[model samples]
Target: MSALILVVDDEPDVAELFRQQFRKELRASRFDMEFAQSAPEALERVGAAEAARLILILSDVNMPGMSGIELLPRARKARPDVPVIMITAYRDSETRPKAIEAGAAGLFTKPIDFPELRGEIGRRLDAATGPQ
Candidate 1:
């Protein structure tokens, strides 16, 4: 089964960007990406039955209602095994620590480095699958 990744960002264009960046993986059926425009929407996805396939969550730090940091614990509470990576335009010291404290597995600065992000995702997925 393809590993599911939920991406939460208020910007509508972010979904297309992720699709472009991970096109090869998607074509290869390695990852299945889903988008949520808001934190509440993401939470609903997390609680849904399909969440069993969810392996990772990528979320923007700033949003209309709930920030990604605020969503971390709630998401974790729903699925403790899923790792969350925060994406933000602001890579300030405060932001990183706060995200970590709130239970984010990692943080990616805006103008995301897709190669680095890809490597991290591969590593995490490998760790999750274990000796496949």
Candidate 2:
């Protein structure tokens, strides 16, 4: 089955950028894309999906209600095998450690390099679900 990635960000433009990049890659492969504007929205999506179909979650660390770190634990609990990658504008010792402690698979700074992030996502997805 194709991997499904959820790009979670508060900003519409940020989510659209991720959608475009991943969609371009998936067009040539077996994969799918989805988006949520907030952590709650992401959780709701997972709940509504009714299974662990979500393979990857790419979320912005800074959000209005709950930061990605705050949501990571819940996301992990909701879908233990699905990996969460935290994206943030601020990178520091504290934030990184907190994200890790909360169960983030990895963390990246904002103004992200989509090509490289896509590669990393591919690697993680491979590791989680196995080849293809």
Candidate 3:
């Protein structure tokens, strides 16, 4: 089965950019991508794919209706095993702790280095799958 990644961001451009980047950057054909523009939408996707097949979630911290911090606990409730990594333009000691406390696997700044990010994501996904 393919490893699925749910990307939640209020910015359509950013979401699409990541989608394209994932496709271009990932060597694995079994990596599937999905996107949501809001926290509620992300939650819905998580609920729908809560079964063990789903792998990871990458979300932006600042959004109109619900920030990533707000969504983290909720997502965890539905899919505790899935790791949610928060992305933001503002990365500092203050925001990082809040995200960690809220249950983020990690935090990344925007203008993300796709190659590096892909490597990290791949590691997390591999970790989720356990030993081969």
Candidate 4:
């Protein structure tokens, strides 16, 4: 079965960006992606069969409600094994520590580098699934 990635971002375009960047992997059935515009919505998607296939969650830190940092624990509650990476344009240094404390596996600053992100995803997935 193909692995799944749940991407949560308040900016609608970010979802498209991830989809486009991962197109090659998606086409190869190496990964499948899903989008959620908010934390609550992302939490809801993290269950059942989808949860089992989900290898990673890429989430933006800033949002209208329940910021990514706040949503971290809740997401863990639903799917404890799934790794979450925080993506944001904000430069506040404090955010990183908070995200780590809240259970984020990594924090990535934006204008995201898709290649780097993809590399990290691949590494994490390999670690999770044992070398594809």
lDDT tens per residue, model 1, 1-132: 777899999999999999999999899988799999999999999998365578899999999889888899999999998999999999578999998999999999989999999998898778766533
Worst 10 residues of 4 by lDDT: 43-52
Q: CA lDDT of 33 in candidate 4?
A: 89
- Badly placed stretches (over 4 Å) of model 4 are none
- lDDT against the true structure, per candidate, is 0.90, 0.81, 0.84, 0.87
Q: How well is each residue in 1-132 modelled by candidate 2, as lDDT tens digits?
A: 566788888998986676676776678755677888888998998777535457888888998998777888889998887888999898677888888888998888877987789789879777767877
Over 81-106, each residue of candidate 3 has an lDDT whose tens digit, in order, gives 88889999985779899999989998
Clashes of each: 0, 0, 0, 0
- Candidate whose lDDT is highest: 1
Q: Model 1 misses residue 123 by how many Å?
A: 1.1
Native-vs-model 3 lDDT? 0.84
Q: By summed lDDT, which 10 consecutive residues of candidate 3 come out lowest?
A: 22-31
Q: What does the lDDT come to for candidate 1?
A: 0.90
Candidate 4 — number of clashing residue pairs? 0
Better of 3 and 4 by lDDT: 4
Evaluation by lDDT, superior candidate among 1 and 2: 1
Q: Which 10-residue window in model 2 sums to the lowest lDDT?
A: 46-55
Alpha carbon deviation, residue 70, candidate 1 (Å): 1.1
- Distance from true location, Cα of 28 in model 1, Å: 0.6
